[model samples]
Target: MSLELKDVEKKVGIDTHIHSTNLKLEKNTINILLGSTLAGKTTLMQIMAGLDKPTTGEIWFNGENVTGKEVQKRNCSMVYQQFINYPNFTVFENIASPLKITGVKSDEIKERVGKVAELLKLSAMLNKKPDELSGGQQQRTALARALVKDSDLILLDEPLANLDFKLREELREELPKLFEDRDCIVVYATTEPQDALMIGGNTATLLEGKVIQYGKTLDVYNKPENLTSARVFSDPPMNIAEINKNGETFKINNNNVQWKSNLKIKDGKYKIGIRPHNITTYKEGNNSVEINGKVLISELSGSESLIHFTNGKLNWVSLSNGIQSKNIGEETKLYMNIDEFLYFDQNNRLVNHG
Candidate 1:
């Protein structure tokens, strides 16, 4: 089975919510829509789920056109960022409601719901109302509802966004394992780049209303097709700076920092993209370049020290491993590895360094 979007576009009057998009997702594979808020992840997923119709192009499901089909007529399940559970019903009732609507046998509903609840670790709470369950339990109930339906397509729209950090991490690790044996097309949408990476699937990075890049999650993360995709995939916002390359060396514009480079690109002006984790307070290797900046903000997250600093006019962030404290307005030096730089042409397309 496959879900294909052919030139699908969604526009409300003159404003476009989803730019023309085309993607084909095969069965039994997890696909992630990775983008920030207002990046059209929801709009695109709605079109795929038949909750919204595309203004242009067709949506094909297993070779049959399903563009205009009502969501109720399709065998698809959706879990939202919100809990979205029936507060009045017990966990079992909430999970069994979909089966009841489809006229499944009572005994079979009991069997199916029982199994799904156990898998989601909700078996002990089958009789508890939604009001009595914790946030994570409520969300899991919603997910269990979706899972028991045996949908041909499952769309999870930032399903873990509202959960606590511990719960989110727990579920994120369990999600892939939950769907490992399911024979359905799983589509998960999230703004967190870390979520997409941990999910381990093909990812389509969205920017504004357009899909910037779509490929294997790590491949797209490691080799983003353009600057927009790179920025979208980065959590702390990737650092960018304009530079001029003359032969084997490039100099940062507006700064005296010059580095000898081996990038196999044309010698001209280009924007260089650097991930925050690559910029650390300490040097990593023999080729690490040192550049000093004034610390604008410094905070610790767990074992990492997030140092936000300003070098000239550019605001850069360094996510250094371990605890390194610094006060604001303090002078701090950052080390950047030149080999990890991503070069982008004038049009923002990534220039291959190979």
Candidate 2:
């Protein structure tokens, strides 16, 4: 079944939590609600789940208006960031709770619970209590409960966020596969840009209670509508700085470095956006513009390194592959690929390279 919201807005006293927005979630597809905290992801989900009512606007499911309906009337299952389970109940009992509440036969409940447990690798600990399980196992139990319900709408609110890095990575890879054959709408909320990319889906990027951009994940990531959208979709944030454009020349850092491009535009001031990964230390001749900067911070993560560099008053970052041993206060050569630059107008709207 499909779910849709029309002109939905949420307000608390004088504060607006979710601005007027409209969205239609397609069936059998993963829809990613991508944004940082207080971006209205949870509020929106709550509205749809009937936990909170929208101050205005309507909600529709499969062409029927369900705005005033209760969550129990909609047949939806939700898994929250924290493990929501009965502390005194065994994992098997917790997974079987929903089915029992709906008065499903014991035989069918057993069959469904067993299949979901095996899928989540929770079969071995079905008899254990919540406190006896590890963090991952506890989360798997929550997921199993949700899956066993066989609800048409599934809302997962950062279910893997509480786990350790290695475990989160493992679950992120496993989640999409878990719902492969389900004919339902899955809405997954996350605060990380990498998480949205990791789970390939249509993404709705929210900012300050507004839906700034919504489209296929890669399209929105590669071509953000404006600076806010770009910042919301980018990790490490996109390096931004004011630049002067004159004829075919674009100058940065008071013209200490000049990049000449064939794109024609009005001579004025604008902001330039360059991704950290697009900036490298290797020199590739005229295709790249080289500049000198002092390293302010360098962080090594696995086989990659993130370097924060500053040139005078200007600060930027470079994400380099392999191990980097650059130290603080060290001078380094940074090359930015001119071809990869995204030019935005003074209003921070992506206008044109020409």
Best by lDDT: 1
Off by over 4 Å in 1: none
lDDT score for candidate 1 against the true structure: 0.93
Measured against the true structure, the TM-scores of the candidates, in listed sequence, are: 0.98, 0.95
lDDT of 1 by residue, 59-172 (tens): 999999999999999999999999999889999999999999999999999999999999999999999999899999999999999999999999999999999999999999
- Best candidate (score: TM-score): 1
Q: lDDT for every model?
A: 0.93, 0.89
Relative to the unseen true structure, what is the C-alpha lDDT of residue 115 in candidate 1, on a scale of 0 to 100? 97
Can you write out model 2's per-residue Cα lDDT over 1-354, one digit (the tens) per residue?
A: 789999999999999999999998889989899899989999999998888899999999999998999888878899999988999999999999999999999999889999999999999999999999999999999999888987888999989889999999999999999989998888999999999999988899999899998888988888888889889988888898889888998998464877888766788898888888888777644689987889999998788889999986688888878877798999999888887788899889986632
